[model samples]
Target: MPYNIPSGSQSNSSGVALARSQNWAFNPPSIDVISSLHILQAQPAAVTLSVSIRDMLASSLATTHSDFNLGITLVQDADALDLFALSSSTHTISNPILLDAAVLLSMQLEVAFVDPTILLEGRYSGYIRFSITATNNSTSIVEEVDLREYSLNLERTGSTTNLLTPRTVNMAYIQGGVSPVLDFDIIPAAASSGSLGYVLSHQGDTVVTLAGTSTSNPPFTLITGDGAVSGTLALDTTIWDSKSLGIHDTVINAIFPDWNVILGMDVNVAVFNAPGAIVAPDVLEFSTLVPDNPQEKFIDIFSTNGFTITAPPWILLSQSSGVDSARIGVMPIDVSNFIQGTYQGMVVITASGNIYEVEVIYQVNDQLETTIDLMDVNFTKDNLYLQVNGYDFNHFLQVESTIKTYDIAGTEFVTTDVVRVPFFNSSARYDVGEFIHESMRWIKDPQAAALGVLDPLSAPARGLYQKLGFVDFNLKVIDRRNQTVRFIRNLNGTKWAPGRSPFNDSNGYHFQNFNDAVARITTEGFGIINIFSKEASSLVLFKNNVEIDSFVLNGGDLPSSRLLIYGGNYLPGDIIKAQINYGTPAIPQLLEKFFVVYPKTDYSCHFLFRTSYNTLEILQCTGKILGFVEYSRQSNTVLKNGVDIINHIQTNRVDPLKVNTGFIPEDQRYMLDVFKRSLAVWLVVPQYTQPIPVSIESTELSHSDNDRFLHAYDCEFKINRDIDEQIYLF
Candidate 1:
């Protein structure tokens, strides 16, 4: 066996040369396009480029450079430069030529093609014209040929690929136990018909096994079936694991009949883990969707292996149950009931014995007939009570009103830009000069004279009441909507603040308003101060001054309320200070105040809810509006004790005001009552501390066509500030 040798060699005259292999049956006899030719002033000599010729039918036919003419012409625009000087030019072969299978039986010829000194800064093209004849050692001419032409392009100024060949392989990320077939293509700087080979290596101690390859040699010659070199590489990743994953880089070299071109590739052997699944849309959020509207959103579930995944019940599957292996689409059921408010839950997915919880939140917005704020005013008799001491038997009064800006979108109006009216006081006086001086004295403390019982006149009545110079006995508060509220004295003098201590005033201290307006409940004539009766039994409670009772009664029944000595001794006005325990207390445990009522003692000075038990102050003094109310779902950071745990979705709502929608006909009176019975029943059961949607309807005295008008729904109400809790049971 004879060692294989290339048929061409590099010419000493700074040029490139390629010869076709003598294994003519394995390769076709043709000319390849000379893609790139470069001439530089730095080069030593005129560049010579050449081609080869051989006898394909007679494998043992002898060949030499003298038997062929190598002609090259350099052309720029319409100008042509004769590079070969003459048509018949030849190059000398370094190795001996033998006409046999062991030898390629071919000759290579390189001409002094381009004059490096004469090369200008412009694009120049050329053509490789080959003429050859083959003969046997007996001197009998076997084949002859005229000149054939192929294009050759050259450049002197712009970036040239003459120094670099761009070769690239597809990125292979193969999982363990799987094989990936990668393909690569090389664009050579100079055109040639050749085969390619690769040198493979691993990064670490991982050993990679490659198999199922047809390439026989590292310096493999390409079999240009149709003038392109292409093949597939099979990589096995079964040996990869957590600790021994493989990353192999391969250097691919194109073995031209003469020169060699090298390129690199990076491979990654991915570790195959266990069987599990992944789901898109980790969170499913549904905006204001109409009730009874068939709305559906899809979620994609995929698994690594062909394992079956179990969907949660709320997530309505298009098919019977779960799916296996493939990516399946699932949607949630439409909200069938016509109940307005936020509904939250989760979409649970169980795959390969693993459970995944995806949070889902949705809200149903109500259609409204009007878009204005309606006043639901409640006047507490005792709240208006003004006491008359020894000064002409005239009572003192003060009123504060909060005018606010609101953002109205559809039917939802969020309060903002709260401007509180300057504190006002009203009282009757005789002498104009003395009245002004005495009025300023009462603002410090309205009960200052009474506080100093030993000498009442010695104590100055300096308080907020005297500062406003109330000329009349009656005080009034007007809101931004021009709704005027009057405050008259409680003639019976049943002050809710009964026990007034001169030494340590039990008077309430004021606190700044909350970031948002919250729900507040108020009732009148139910019961007096420190009264624990059925009417006054049901009371609203607060926790951390935030969780105020949105519902005064639950399930048509009042929450269980009892009077027990909470923090301190039961003073006359201790009920106003002590915490009011709510919910059914089976065996009333004597614990400390668990539910801290809102508007704590601040009702006396600051604006408060109407239900508050304050004599000089009307309880429902709306506070300062900070910003626009946001109707969107808010993500809350859940905390356990002091550490952060997870995120939760929360919604907000405000208390509703009653307003008449429309009136029914006289003949429809009985029919309207019957229709209310068939309507959906609303319940106020707090689920996961979230506000429950409730409907309160009543027939008004106004009638049209003998039918009474009905007022239902609280459109002004806002949901709780924090409503994020997983309601889905898996």
Candidate 2:
């Protein structure tokens, strides 16, 4: 057994060497294994699968996943055909598996990485890599698997921290018989750090640029991590293109009608920004600049927006400077004493390049005039006379003389004589006896006598003489030198008979002659001589004692010695006595002499006599006797006794001699009585009503009647009512 078989045919030996070489190529061992085997025994060549379980498991999992796929194929280089049947078993498995059995079933598997995981941190940089493989089951065929490299970058984007997945190849695979190399850069999305940095920095229409780099072209994209990019950036400068430092919507209104000097006007100015920008230094300046030497200057400024300045201190005015607006005020000047024309001035307003001016005009007026009215006229003296009032006497005098005279006797006489007798044997001298005899002849005519007459030297005497119907004549006097006589003619003419002249005639020698003779005898004739002489003394005694019977014939009381007697003398022994008869039928009879007296014995004589004489016969008889004796007395005694007799006769006489009666007729006496009654009624009537006040007015009617009505408005008050009470008016 151990012996080698003799070498057979040389051709068979060559075939054995070819077979051994083929076996050695298929199963080549290490040198130790070959030495060990040579020392022991010879072996046959073996074929096995060389697939890693992890790789195979990965390949098997990749082949079943949808996100990634794996494919395997076996292709023999000699046949050039894929063996799908040999790879079908491994492909049918759902999970990973190892490659162990082989009957020339070469594995051809495809692997792919599916659903790859990505991770990121705060602001970090890193890389991620995944592996895939492909296997080939065939005779002498090779396969490869590839994984594409992905790079991820993490950054801050918003308030949240996130691992943003970067964009990469979504679908990639490594198949059998292909390159197993994949290269890709990973870009991690910007992560929000939950801080302010993540907020968007752009506002409005601004653009924000985030800085980043990527191996992939166009790597960076802006992401609004959070919705809170709200803050405004810089203000839109376009909106402020027409900006101005001015005012808008201005309004002006007045508070009063007229302006005054001391008080200033108030105004409000409202200013605001143009909707966006804020105003800086919001205060406004309001000032009026007047020239230093301004001539009648005045100004006024006002505003509508709120911008004001401090009021001037010296001016006495009230203002609202505390408001936020602009305003101005004007003061009135006392220009009354200035020029009388219109004055011009200016008001300059200085407010932030805004200027305004106004003109002021002042008018001057003249002073007012005043006047007074007078009510009374002045005079020189208190007492005024119609004749001698005002300037001079001659101015008001209308007559020749201021004094007036009137005749006393001849002009005032009212009697007329029938005839007159011659006086003292002269034709020019006439006796009144003829006139009296004629007057007695014509008893129906009244008798009166003229006592005396007066004459005036200047002016006419006709007015005086005509008042009494007397003729005025100038007569020449014989005895009295340088004496002019004014004679008033008697009523009757002279007449005489033969041997019996009108003068010194017995018929003319009447009781008046006897009176003259007796008065001379008693006062100064023999009666006085007897009282002083002795021879004449007996005659005086005889005459005084002798009582003549005829002397006592008349009945009544004896006459007083003061009475004139006719043709009688006083004797030294003459006695007179008065007896009173006072009783029933009282009779006054002669009794005895009351006293003894002598004529011309003394200058005094008793002329008054009182008696209780009754009986009309005795009174009449005594009056006759006394009348005869009264005419025989001297002119002086006649005058004295005549006045007493006339007074006594006037008192005692029953019938008075009728003189010239007044012109009032007896028929008109009733009318006069009625007028007097009406006057009495007016005086006694009681007034009950108020009197109407009378107003007088005088005006010049015409030139003709001007002088006639010179003294006008001469009014007098008639008492019509009792106006004594005080009246009050409301």
Where is model 1 poorest over a 10-residue stretch in terms of lDDT? Answer: 8-17
Superposition TM-score, candidate 1 onto the true structure: 0.17
Q: What stretches of model 2 exceed 4 Å from their correct place?
A: 1-301, 304-338, 346-359, 364-730
Instruction: Please give the RMSD of candidate 2 to the true structure.
Output: 82.4
**TM-score of each candidate structure, all chains considered together:** 0.17, 0.11
For candidate 2, the TM-score is 0.11
Give me the candidate number with maximum lDDT.
Answer: 1
Cα-based RMSD of the predictions, in order?
41.3, 82.4
Per-residue lDDT for 518-545 in model 2, tens only? Answer: 2233322111110001010011112334
lDDT of 1 by residue, 95-178 (tens): 223333322333333334444334433434444433333432333433332223333333344224322122322222325544
